[model samples]
Target: MNGLSPSRRRARELVEPQHWVSGATESVAGLCQFVLLLRLGATLMLVVAAVLIEPDPRTLLLGTLVAGTVTAAELAVLVRHPVAVVRWPVFVLVELVAGAAIAGLMEGGPVFFSFSCGSAAVFGVAAGLRAWPVWVVQTVAAYAVVAWIIRADDVPATLAVYLTGVPTLYVLVGLASATARAAVIRHVNLARSALEAIERSAVAAERTRVARELHDSVEKTLRGLSFAATSLPQAVQQRPQLAAELARTVAEGARTAADEARELLGMLRADDLDASLAQAIERACQEWAVRTGLRADTDLADVEAALPVRHEVLRIVREALGNVARHSGAAHAWIDLVREGSTLRLTIRDDGHGFTVPGDLNHLSAAGHYGVVGMAERARQIGGRLRVFSGDDLGAVGGTQVVLWAPAGAMAPMSDRVRT
Candidate 1:
């Protein structure tokens, strides 16, 4: 059966008709142009061969003019409006006519036959499977033209080869071009699907980050305000001093919640995340030093990482710095980012009086100290681990050291990672 092959059928089933049309028009435009360029070069060679072999000057001039005109027309169509060449069937018929004209003018010469086969390939690539009938018609026309030339002129032994071999070559080249076009479109579609999946994963990770920010900042403050307000009415009737204190606490908590919400919004709207990892980290350190008036030193290496890894690492660095400013009471801080083998290590140290770190970092969440807990969660999301070495853990010296170790090729989003 001369129907669609199994591979083509499978491709048709997988891709919608509209997608096929669009992909052929957009994804294969460059390929089509390349094939047409090859055809143009072959035509020029055929013309050169004809000029040297043909005895009649007028016939040679006319044939060269015809071939050049046809080639120019094809090039114009491909260059000016590539979409029309693939989307419209008229271009296929035009190519078929141009091939017949050139082959017939050359009296079915072998070089012209090859040029005609080139036309078949261009047809197959541009029109795909839907233009098989045009290819059949062109093949038959080629055979008919060659037969007519052999019959009219004194037939040579070699002229007999064009009758059978030319049509067969046309079919083979056409099929091969069609298969190649299908493969290219399939690969492009697969790549597009993967990109879309990655985008969805990134969106989900962003949502999770937003939820975590609210939970650690505004949500906690608002919950505390709600409790204080609930107690305010009862305290006012019993003890006036307690009611006044509760009122002040509620006012401060509300303002703190508002400020945190604004800061979260600002972070979300920031485009600094697009900067290089080194620049983003160095900028974070500089901004923190300026805000807290603390001496900051950085030893950052010029290294690259995936966006998600850089994102989590930057967030963790900011969180650790915030902890140093708020809790460590350190006058000086040092940050280091270096790559060790396949692992990336970031260390932030402060020479301040450090508190006792819990045996389990998760336990700090219960005490409303979510800074370290959040930093640990962020590290884990990027398939990394964080360690806190406080003064108690590190001999009797009073200082804190926060270290994060992550894989350098951290491309996957948090949704794909195993959460503990």
Candidate 2:
């Protein structure tokens, strides 16, 4: 059953436009195949019926042989280069010319008349599916042909066929064809919009991460340097020892800042984007455990997500773990990542001294707790929500829980719930 599921899915993917017909030239290839098969069957049946009923079999056979040859050549071209036939003018012209030849060869027979109606129906449906305007023009041209044919034979019988059969079959088939085309186009547009939203979210999240990194590393260091330089002259005039100490402190801070800046740059250049989200999370947990002496229990599930989404999730987990090490003072922590239908849920909990979470995430930024703000921003970028549950209000013994929920495909629009 498990093996069959994947095979079934692979078979379904084979027919999708993205996989089967990736170019504009082959866009209608699938539709062409359907119409070609329908036309082939109708043409063969008409030819067979006409051959069996005609009184002069030899003349009818010869005419059929010529018409069949022409149809075969046209059909071969239609099958090989379908895009050419989809153009409105070309489609109408080709169908009219071919239909006229076939109809003309067997002018007055019941089978010939039936073949004309069938040909018109097929052409109308195909045109409607490709372009409604072409279908309109084909219908007009087809009615004129039917009128001319019926005038020579039984006027009442031909008019009945024209009024009842031709329009009914063509309209019904055309409606179905138009509906199918519209549905496919709608789904394609929705998929494209979803991808664009995901891209925008990723860009926003990346910007937030870069800004936070710069503020934490370069900006903080530069601020210290400015303060030290300002106090240097006062220190030198008041006390020689103080002046030397200030000078040393200023030098050390500058070096520390420069090293931190370099480290940040190296982190930005890291190639972890290629790694699976679960693997990245597990690796980060291992590193965190080693650094903090806190045991991390991870429950990582195999789930697929976009690279940008995975990167943001990884960062959120890192921020949550960093909080656990720096402030929670917890002996142990747990990380859970699992696929839940259309969404992926990540939960990180630590048995530590929990702090009260402000109702507004913006307050965290004001309090200089950029890590929490950064985590929230990451969640927002992937159209996900970040929830923090902690403090004495909780029933469990002092602990904190940080939960992040993201769309499974990571193509949903940015969540309004995620604070700016």
Candidate 3:
């Protein structure tokens, strides 16, 4: 063991026999106790049969005493504390001695022989596979005791063969139980690892969502408040009317920023992701239209998406609508949600004076256009792409068009659609 490589040594430590009972899962522990109960029941029944069948009174008394003592010890130690039998070497020797004594005094009688085999099986299960040396010792002792009984009593040749062959059941039963225990432990460990990984993934996704929410909503509002406050001092001395407008802008921006922060907090606390994606988008457009007094028209298709994808999609829509309200200078907005074969397409277009589409949307954050950058990120996170068409560069008349195309892999089956 000492000469083995580190990995091999670790592997050896993992499969060590004593670890079976020491690190037993609830299922394995229950298995051990169940086998012990079976052994105890068999022992009582066989001991009573031996007493009734034996013509020699003294031999019957001796056999019964040995069996009774072993059963009592098992009840006192193995039953109440099953691990104690495996942990202590003394208990191991006691089981071995009891098996030999019962075999010798009972003269390899059919019932007593079966009881000895049951003892071997119980020991094998309790001791585990790694303790093969103990099993070997127990098997050899059983063979030796039966051999003595065969020679001393004129045992039949058929009975002799049966006595010799039964000892091997010890090794067979032991190997089978040990292998089963190992397999069960391995599967349980795998299941535990999978659950932990899922938990970690959930935590990471939530952190990303919160970060995106701040960038998309509260951060943008605060940036507007900062600009309004910065220009207020200059306007105060030169132009009182302009100063009053700037002051009002600052006060309103502050209130809007606070409201955005509170709404974000409420969303975090709520389980709103279970709502239907199509219905949710339509409702959001209607609400935004009422709030901003813009004529919002929505053409939505029946669609379903996984919760994470739905969440990112909703944020992107909200950010796009907010952009229209703040900078579009348009009186009407058109929203379209449709499925194109294996892709989900969402388009938000406003009839406002369009800005130039940047070469790289990611650089929008540096240009203080965090909403657009956040929308682009949301698109990418859901295995999708965001395209911005504005000005004459994309054949647009006088408005901005934000389009998102998400792959089918990010979506749930239509059958999984949740109704609002």
Clashes of each: 0, 0, 0
Candidate 3's C-alpha lDDT?
0.72
lDDT (Cα atoms) of all candidates against the true structure: 0.76, 0.66, 0.72
lDDT of 2 by residue, 193-286 (tens): 7887989997897788789768855797688788888889998999889889889878987986786676566556652766666777887788
Q: Candidate 3 has what TM-score?
A: 0.54
After TM-score superposition, the amount by which residue 325's alpha carbon in candidate 2 deviates from its true location, in angstroms, is: 16
- The best candidate by lDDT is 1
lDDT of 3 at 91: 48
List clashing residue pairs in candidate 1. none
For each candidate, give its TM-score against the true structure. 0.76, 0.50, 0.54
Between candidates 1 and 2, the one scoring higher on lDDT is 1
lDDT for position 222 in model 3:
86
Better model by TM-score: candidate 2 vs candidate 3: 3
lDDT of 3 by residue, 1-420 (tens): 679887545534543433432244344545655665676677667657766776665765666567666766665665565445334345466766776676666665644555555555555555556558876876787687678878888889998898788778777877877776667667766776787799999899889879978887788888888888888899899999999999988888788788778767755754355666777887778778888898888877767676687787877888899899998899999888777887889999999998988799877777767778878887888899999999886573779999999864344454544332
What overall lDDT, based on C-alpha atoms, would model 1 receive against the true structure?
Answer: 0.76
Query: For residues 241-260, could you state the per-residue lDDT of candidate 1 as single tens digits?
Result: 99999999999889878877
